[model samples]
Target: MSRTPNPTRTLASQTLFRGLDVVDAVADGCQSVQEIADRTGVAFSTTHRLASALVQARYLQFEPRRGYRLGTRLLELGFAAYRDSDIARSARQNIEQLAGETRDTVHLAMLDGDEIIYLDKIDAQRPIGVNSRIGGRKPVCCTGVGKALILDEGEASWRTRYQYDAERGNIHLPLETWLAGMHAYAQGGYAFDLEENAPGIRCVAVPIRDASGKTVAAVSVTGTTDSTDEARLRSLIPTVRGAAQAISAKLGGTLG
Candidate 1:
């Protein structure tokens, strides 16, 4: 026997979907009830009711001047989700895949007091791979992963790190040139090491962000100059960035 659909259940499901649409519209910057209704194609009265319910549930907030905005409840949920995330474990599979694809060294690193510490490293099977290991620390001014870690920082911070590296004789480029390069890299959302970290070694790197869109770590792929020429290094940028983005997505983030 064919069964007819229940009217109450159908209405409830439609209401749930409409409520979610309202939330999406608000999140996308539809502040006023009429704006949300226009965006969601819901009637004005229904949109007002939905927004009021959402405000009562703490998913949205209303102010005198500002119509609607995301409430603190979403922030609390984001924090809780990030607190339970393990970045190293989350990044392992992606980095491993990157190494396997490129047949080169892969590194996952985080900034630590003006330096970057390697949280994970996948060494290439080749004999002449980079000599970095897990827990190794490197200067933050001359390495690809190091630059990626600071992409969101201001020029003042960049100068501070550059000066620190220069005092230690770790910097080879002039401050002006390095700063210019950093500006370009920051704008491009990636960085490169043109034999700056070690002679004959080159790398491409991208930042790994957290749920709140903070650059919490970095990922890089490195190879010798002979193996990774200019064209080859440029070709590896997308692959390295893909690995970093995968890690960021696992951490409840999205890459820009």
Candidate 2:
């Protein structure tokens, strides 16, 4: 299934590798052109030119003495791309529809590194509104939607990615708790937020499985404590699950 590397290919160009090293050096806090050159073993002139090009492209910012740092433009572009993503587009209508149906705030979230990133939300018609914003992050260990998404990933992944913070008081819990919750989720085909993320808010989430049957995203509904009664939320599960299924279908998810 594999071929050996060509010696010529491996040895041919030092410039490409040097350029990569310069970038790595810059990212690691070698702000000054000279510092970058020294750190990367590239020529000072080359480092200067590369740094200048990066600054021009707005990937880096230049300071007279401090040299350079990451630019705000990268963050702006990243958020723009994320907001306009296919996941966001596919989930938007369903999230809104669910919110309308349940008179609750609905959210769409995805995993980003070690945390859950909220990509979009729809607010209920009530006087008080949910405070979560687009692009907000919540810890995976405590949030319902986040834990559900990971649990849907199966046991091995869950064990690999999360740890029990005993100091935080059975943060991972005994195996029994994890197993019971997962069993409930699989049986119900949906997950609960359970006021773990916030004291007063409760949420229900369903997986947005893709064509390959992978949990690529999650859709959730949130509401005030008074309205998020257990029975009321149990009744809302079908609506939330239906909305998620619609979104998954729109995104070409291979549902059986």
Candidate 3:
């Protein structure tokens, strides 16, 4: 059993928050202990100690000259959580059909903070397919799957998410431009990524809303620009949207 915290122990609990701060710093791209300390506003020695402890605990890993990165424990936990997600499980067959029909990679994704995580990916049998994985993350503001997942959010809230990302130092995407694109996508009931997330890939996506009418996830079909130009992507929108609806229904999600 965990012991009750005395005053000294209660004060010491700040270390737990500090350690988490360091972890967040690393997630935000701070690699070295000095960088983590600088970002977290903690002393260098304290940051190093906490980072060292995290490394020992397998929450972080060190490479001889490469500094620190997220460890295997995170991958284990992430996959465990993803594998247990009902949406991911329910959407697999629908995603497979989308891929098979389009002869392009299809994805099931869920919003994670200011990002979208690929919960499942069905690769096309053809030689050309997207280079994404089941557990990879991408910026939500620029990806079709991400925009579709957040389509219901108000413009202000959308900008707020961009702000959250900016605070974390991810400012590559411009807010005003993205908001304009998001507005069009939301109105259209489907989103498109035209070389936004990747230079040569195009995608069409629609939201997966639960029975309560809450957007719970998103589904997208991805293809190469060579094979899927704007005209092709526009044509495939209905197919992708239909696939999303099928998965939503399977998940007890709303069709409307």
Global lDDT of each candidate? 0.90, 0.76, 0.85
Question: How many Å off is the CA of 163 in candidate 1?
Answer: 0.7
Report the C-alpha lDDT of model 2 over 1-256, residue by residue, as the tens digit: 8999887877656655776676667667888888898998878998888778777878778989687887776678767987779999888777877888887888899888777888888878775456677877777656667865775667766665456423344244555676577677866777776666667778888878888888888888888788778777788888888888898998889434
Count the clashes in each prediction.
Answer: 0, 1, 0
For candidate 1, the lDDT comes to 0.90
Error of 1 at 53 (Å): 63
The digit string of per-residue lDDT tens for model 1 on 1-256 reads: 9999999999999999998898778878899999999999999999999889989988889997999988877668755754554988899899999999998899999999978988888888675658687766899999999999998997999999999999999889999999999999998899999999999999999999999999999999999988889799888888888998899999999778
* TM-score of model 1 (CA atoms): 0.66
Clashes of 3: 0
Error of 3 at 52 (Å): 2.2
Query: Which residue pairs overlap in candidate 1's backbone?
Result: none
Model with the higher TM-score, candidate 1 or 3: 3
Models 1 onward score TM values of 0.66, 0.67, 0.80
Tell me how candidate 2 scores on lDDT. Answer: 0.76
Better by lDDT, candidate 2 or 1: 1
